[model samples]
Target: MANTPGAKKAARKIARRTEVNKARRSRVRTYLRRFEEALSAGDAAAAKTAFVEAQSELMRAVSKGVVHKNTGARKVSRLAAALKKLGGSAA
Candidate 1:
């Protein structure tokens, strides 16, 4: 319970920010899922495209403070590795 006006305003701002961050997180997850599906299906081209989109979304989330910088980097790294593996297998 926020008693003071400033506290109340902060609470409201936090609530709004939470909703926005949630949406961003969900969007990132969706992109990641798409990438995973493409990878698992052995479609190197589609996986590469999805990987790019997922990396973009992940970095955007990191820039927006929805995710930590290191976590984003790690995820992007792993996704790239997986994409590389897929490419290797197809070729």
Candidate 2:
């Protein structure tokens, strides 16, 4: 359906961008999951570290336009609160 040269190029770009965005989103999910698992396991240190790393990864997603800025901020806030509670009790 993409007959024109510009259209063909645009289609290719879209395909490549889609694949990149998918990978980025998956990576962000992996980081978030790590934090969750650590928190659930009651590993305060691990959970704190994971939360920091996940926050960075999430901010990167926002920068890449894969996620909204406020969404990232909200997720980070919730996760940090979880980490705080876990760490506080464990300490």
- Which candidate comes out best when scored by lDDT? 1
Worst 10 residues of 1 by lDDT: 82-91
Candidate topping TM-score: 1
Q: Encode model 1's per-residue lDDT on 1-91: one tens digit a residue.
A: 9999999999999999999999999999999999999999998989988988999999999999999999999999999989888773322
For model 2, how does the per-residue alpha-carbon lDDT over 29-78 read when each residue is reduced to its tens digit? 99999999999999888897888889999999999999999999999889
Steric collisions counted per model? 0, 0
TM-score of candidate 1 against the unseen true structure: 0.94
Task: Candidate 2: list runs displaced more than 4 Å.
Answer: 88-91
Candidate 1 Cα misplacement greater than 4 A, ranges? 88-91
For model 2, the run of ten residues with the poorest summed lDDT? 82-91
Which residue pairs collide in model 2, if any? Answer: none
lDDT of 1 at 76: 92
Using all chains and alpha carbons, the TM-scores for the candidates as numbered come to 0.94, 0.91
